[model samples]
Each structure stands twice: as structure tokens, then as C-alpha cells.
Target: MRYAKFSMDDPFISMAEVRALVEGEVHFLAGVALLPDGREKIASRSSTVKVSGKLLSASHDPKEVNEAIRGRCFSIYPDVILGRDKNMFRALYSEATKGVETSKRCPKLDLVFTDGVIVAGIREEERDSKSLREHSMKPFSQSGTMDPFTSRLMVNLARVRKRVLDPFVGVGSILLESAWMGLDCVGVDVDPSMVTKAKANLSHFNYQCHVIQGSVTSLNLVGGFHVVTDPPYGRSSSAKGATLRELYAAFLSVSAELMERGGRLVFASDSREDWRDEIRSAGLKTVSTHLIYLHKSLSRAIYVVERG
Candidate 1:
């Protein structure tokens, strides 16, 4: 079995997105999720799933936890971390790892306590360039620009094959994450200023991607098997003189043309409409939908669709 620990702050989105990415049966414990071993292979490109590795052992007793880590190579000492319980697990972890051996040339070990159990596993290191915190200062940003973590989460959930397309790319947040994952990226925007800003933002991070100043309704390109974007909904930017319903309908129609068969599309919208008619008209099937409540008046909906 392999253990995947998620960030506790946003458990709903984290669980939903990861469930879409991985295959096979996944059992969710308190703060960690267990995936069937050898059936899943992720490149470790996630913001919510912080740690993942082969399960070494799971136990409730302190002595059994100590026995589980016996003779394991660790750089310095294993760090005990909490997933749920704070006060009680701290002392139990302290007793479990007392006088443990460590080496300088070995991987670090982490003990995660959650749901009244201690799970010991080797921590997987992530690529620093793909981190969202690296580029805190963006060249251009709007009021409702998607954050790097959420943007990358959508990209990962799209199940990208080779190339990624963002039809409503604003400042290239989604494109930046796609490029970092070593995938070909193309972005389009109706506003010329947004096109320039998106290019600048991608260049600042030393990522190469194609950006075009065009509307999604008339986008004349193909070969983006995965499409992820956050469209303008009159909050951060205008819909370029089109109503929300009209923009969404046109965008979905063009998206069906740009994508190959079985291609995946993930997008965010604040409209409460279910979009069943638009999705069916475009010959696309709705795979899943996730709703995130931001405030009393606003809630964002993420839709995953597949071209048939």
C-alpha cells in the first residue's frame, strides 16, 4: 500500500482532485489517504498532496512504531509530524524515536499521526521549480486571477497527455504550471493587454509557451488534449461584450473543435447554472463537478468534461 497525505486546510478539493487523478481504490483515513500499491504512478506534481510514499508500517502502539523504523537509514533523525492529534501524538512520537540511528547520506523519514495511528514512510522530494511559492511576485495580476496552487490543481486534474491549452488565459498562471510539468502549452485571450501580461509572467519564470490575442469563440488551433482555464465572468474582467451564458456557450462549442476525441477539459465558473444544455450541445459529457464556497455571495464551480 502507498500513503498519500493531503493538506488539512482544504480537504474537500484535495480529496476530490486527487481522486480524479489516481486510479483504483482509495481509502481516506483521518489526514491520510491510502492508495493501492503499484496501481498508481503520479509524477508528484501536486500542491495539496504534500507527501506520498510506500507504507512502511501502521501501528497504534509506541513500541510497535519503534520496531517499524528499526535499522532504517535516515539522515539525522526521523522527524515526527502530526496529521490530526496534536498533544497526545507528540509525546507518543517522542517515545517511539528515542535514541534512533541516523546517517547523513540517507533519505529523511517522517512519522505521520492521524486517526489514532502512526504511519511511517519515506518522504518524496518535489521539484522546486514547480512550487507555487517560488514566484510570489507576478508581473501582472487581476482581482480574480487564479492562484498557482488552484491553477496547477486544475491542470493536474485534467490528466494532461502532452499539450495544455488555456483559452481564457489571464496572466498565464495555468500556462506556467503546465510548462513546469514539461508539457507544451498554448494560451489565448481576447484582450491584447492580457496577452502581453501572460507572456511576461511566463517569461519571468523562464517558461516557454505560445500566447495569442484571440477569442475562444474563433480559436483556430488544435492538438491540446487537455484544456484548463479560468474564464472571465464580469468579476475581474469583462466578457468582451458578451453575456456570461453566451460566452460559455461559444467557448464550449469552440472547445469541442479544438480538442481531440477523449480529450479532457477543466474550467472554473461562478455561475449557478448547471450548464447541462451547453455541455450536451457541444457533444461533451460531464465527468465531474466540484463546488467551492468562497463567501456568502460567491461560490466557484469546477467542471470536468470529456469530448466524445
Candidate 2:
């Protein structure tokens, strides 16, 4: 079995489970998760996952861990724990490997204690901090641009089959994540300036994506592409003279048209209303909804829908 440990105390932590499910079949217990083995790639690229590894053992007794890890060449690495005693787990690890032989250079083992479960596993993948830092520091940025981790989460939620489309792409925040996953990317914006900025940002990261200056309502493209976008919230972003309701309805209609049957679309909105009417009208099925509190006055609802 494989397991993932999520960052604690994040308002977006709730989305971690959904993201895990979207990427692979996994079960969440508190902030720690157990996923089927052979999902190293999925765990590596996930925004919410901190560390993932092959489980060696999960038991209260350190002898079980010691027995499972005997004769294995590994170094003990303690990961940050949530809702558990860190030093206790460290001592447990020390006890488990006291007499066992290990190699300090490669194949490290991570000790994770959370929700009263003790897990010892062989470390396989970790978050790419350097890449994430570079993506977050893109040359062109705006006030309402989605944060890098959240942007990546949106893309991951879509589970892009082949291509990704961002109808309200602003500065290519979501597109960059899609590009990082080596997926074909197409971005459209009503504002020509935003279109240019999006292209520039994508190019800055050495990502080649198709950027078009057009409204989602009038845009046309081949079907079967997954969609991920964060539409205008009308505070720092302009609505282009369309009400939130109208803009969202149009967005849904266009998305439904472009997506093939069973294609996924993950979109975000700041409005409190869930847009059930628009979703039903567009013949889309609601898969799930995740609420992320950005600040005191700004909470965004991320909706995952499938074209039917």
C-alpha cells in the first residue's frame, strides 16, 4: 500500500481528498491517506500532498515496523506530523531501527504519525518546491490570479484526458499548471490585454499554449477537452458588461459544447449561489463542490462537473 500526508491547517485541506480521488483511488483518514500502490507519479505532482511512500507497516507496536523493515537498506526520515507527537514518532523510529542495518545515502524511509496511526514507509516522491516557486513568480501577475497551488489543484481536479481549456484564462495561472503536466493547453479571454498577458506568462515558463482573444459565449473549438478556469469575480476583474449569472451561464454553455460526453470541467466562482440552474440547463452533471476561504470576505466555491 501507498500513503500520502497532507499539509495541515490549510483552508484548502478539504480539497485534498477530492484531488486524491480525482487523480487516483485513495482513502483519506484525517490528513493522512492510503492509496493503492503504484501511484508515485500521481503523488509526486499533487499540490496538496506533501509526501507519499510505500507503506512498510502501520501499527502501534514498533516491533511490527522493525520486523517489516529488517535487512532493508534505508535511512530514517521523519516527516512533519499533524495532531500527533513528533518526537515520540522519532523515538519510535529510532527504536524500530536500532539494531537494523541501513544505508544513509538512498532509499530513505519516512515516519508519519497522524490521527493516532503510526506509519513507516519508503519515501518515493515529494513536492517539487523549486518548480512551484518558479511558477508562482511568473513575470506577469494580477490581484485576482489564482494562487499557484490552488491553480494546480484545479487542473488536477479536471484529470485532463488530452487537452485543457481555460475560457476565462487570466494571466494563464491555470494554464501554466496544465502545461507543467505536459497537456495541450488552450486559453481564451474576452479582453485582448489579458490574452496577451496570458501568452506572455506561458511563454515566460517556456510553455507553448494557444491563447485566443474571444468571449466564451462565441468561442468554438473541437470537443473532448477538459476545462479548468477561474472566472471574473468583478472586484479586481472586469465582467465585460455581463452579470455574474449571465457570464457563468454562458461559460457553462460554452464549456458543455466543447467538452465530450463524460469530460470533466472544474471552475471556481466567488458568488454564494451554486449555479444549479445553469448546470442543469447546460446538461452537465455536478460531481462535487469544494469551498475554499481565501479571506474574510472572499470565499471561492470550486465546482466539478461532467458533460453529459
Candidate 3:
């Protein structure tokens, strides 16, 4: 549905994540757009504009914009007008309510202008970053723990309502986020210390998840899980004697076997090596790829793959 203007944690990652989660038509507008089957997903949770109309000219005066907004809000009978900031849209809101009586509480007409385009709609939802932050601050966190925002994004991108698996769960970040989204989660790690810490971390959040200490390649897990993981990487990674590519190839090969038909896998890596051959050999199809630049020397490649 239509979304309001809000700062994304990372626009590129958010866009890619939304595309992966949404199953139908998607259209990008000025400050909002239409997304199919994403009403309940996290990708839609940050949106403020619930219902919207066609784009309007950014140069339109307050009166003209208000008239257009009034036409869109006719069915809802919004009593309050809200803008993204106290700038042009605020003037528009004031002008719109000049001859109108304000209600104590009613539907709100929301406006957002971006890149010479104006989007008008009705307000619906707001994101709670505070609660998300609280959940992210587990008692036992480590350097490798995934950030809550990205963890939640990855879980949503998986688009699995039933179950999710993180084969390289570090401190239970992915598992915790999946459980927070009301999905049954399982996490496997080769390090017993990590597994124990992950379990404790989940407990601190009062979340229930299966945390096991086992190698991802040898784990006897039941098929049918949407997997999302950030495997061990870098010079300090616990890859034993194998190269990064070799470890990734082995994990993907076994992951393909552990996934149900049509299951999706979301992976992240910092390696600059090309993995097209490894991905194909693992019997998975690449759905999308995104690159996130963390710093001058560090960039991550995110891949969304589907089991064949």
C-alpha cells in the first residue's frame, strides 16, 4: 500500500528486502507506492500513508494541493491533516483546514513531498523503533551479532510465516528477530559457546527458539524452512582449513537438501570472489543480489536464493 516519507536504515537494502518479500505488483511513487501482500509484513510497518491517490505536482499551491487531498480523503472524512515535516506540507495542512472544524480524534490526512512530487494519503501505522531497540539489546551480545533492523529485514524478506532457520546463528540475533515476528525459529552453530550464548540471549527477550550446537552441513534438520544467515567470514572466521568459497559451497549444498521445495535462502558475505558457479552447483536459483557498503574497506553482498 501507500507509504509515508520515512528515513530507511539503508535504502538499497530496504528496497531489495521489500522486493523479495512482496509477491505481486509494486509501483514506486513520490513518497509512497503500492505493494502487493505486504500489509502485515515488517516492510509495511513503517508506512504512515495507509490510503493514497495519484501523484500531484510539487509546485502546486497549498489550496490546490488541499483540494486534491480533500478529494482523496472524501470517503474517509479525515478531520486532521498531517505532514512529514513542518515545511511545505505543513503550510498545505494549515491551508486545507482554514475553513474546516477540527475534531478531537478522527482519521488524518497525510502529505509528503519528495523529489518534485507530492503524495497525499490517510495515516494508518507508525513504527516503534524504541521497542525494536530494546529487543535488540540482548544481555549477551557479540561482535558478530546481527543488528536488529537488518535481522528483522532479513526475516521479512524470507516471507515465511511458519518457520525460519539460521544455520550460523550468532548470539541468536536472526532467531530472536524471527521469533519476534511470530515465526517458529531454529538456529544451528558449530560453536557450543555461541549456541549457549544464543540460547541465553533468546531467554533474555523471553522468546522461545531451538538453538542447537551442530555443524550446518551435518545437522539432521527436517526440510521446509526458509533460511536466512550471515555465515562466518573474514580472516578470523572459523572456517577450519577450507577457503571461504569452499565453506560457502559446502553450506549451500547441504542447505539445498535441508530446504523444502520452493523454500528461499537469504545469505550475506563480505568476500569479493564471484560465487555464481558455487550458487548454481548448490542447486539454488538466484532471485536477487544487493551490495551494502559498510565502509571504505568493507562491503557486503546479500543474495536471495530459492531452492530448486
TM-score of each: 0.85, 0.90, 0.80
Winner on TM-score between 2 and 3 is: 2
Residue 183 shift from truth in candidate 3, angstroms: 0.6
- Model 2, position 148, has a per-residue lDDT of 84
Every candidate's lDDT? 0.78, 0.79, 0.66
Point to the candidate with the largest lDDT. 2
Query: What lDDT tens digits, residue by residue, belong to model 3 across residues 1-308?
Result: 44433344455555555455456766654434555433443333322222433333233465665665443323223222224444655555566545444453655555555543445555555455665778677888876567776677677666676889999997888888787777889999988989999999889878899999888768798888888998976855555677767788888998888778888888888747566788899988888777766678877777788886
lDDT of 1 by residue, 1-308 (tens): 77777776768777876676677888886657777877443427776777677777778887887887776667532333452467787798777776667777878676777777887776663324346876546788877788887887899778886888999988888998899889999999998999999999989989999999998878878564678999866534446677777888898988888887888899998857678789889889998887867678878888989997
Global local distance difference test of model 2: 0.79
- Tens digits of per-residue lDDT, candidate 2, 178-200, equal 88888999999888999989999
Candidate 3 Cα misplacement greater than 4 A, ranges: 4-9, 36-38, 41-106
Itemize residue pairs with steric clashes in candidate 1.
none
Candidate 2 has a TM-score of 0.90
Task: State the lDDT at 263 in candidate 2.
Answer: 88
Q: How close is candidate 3 to the true structure, as a TM-score?
A: 0.80
Clashing pairs in 3: none
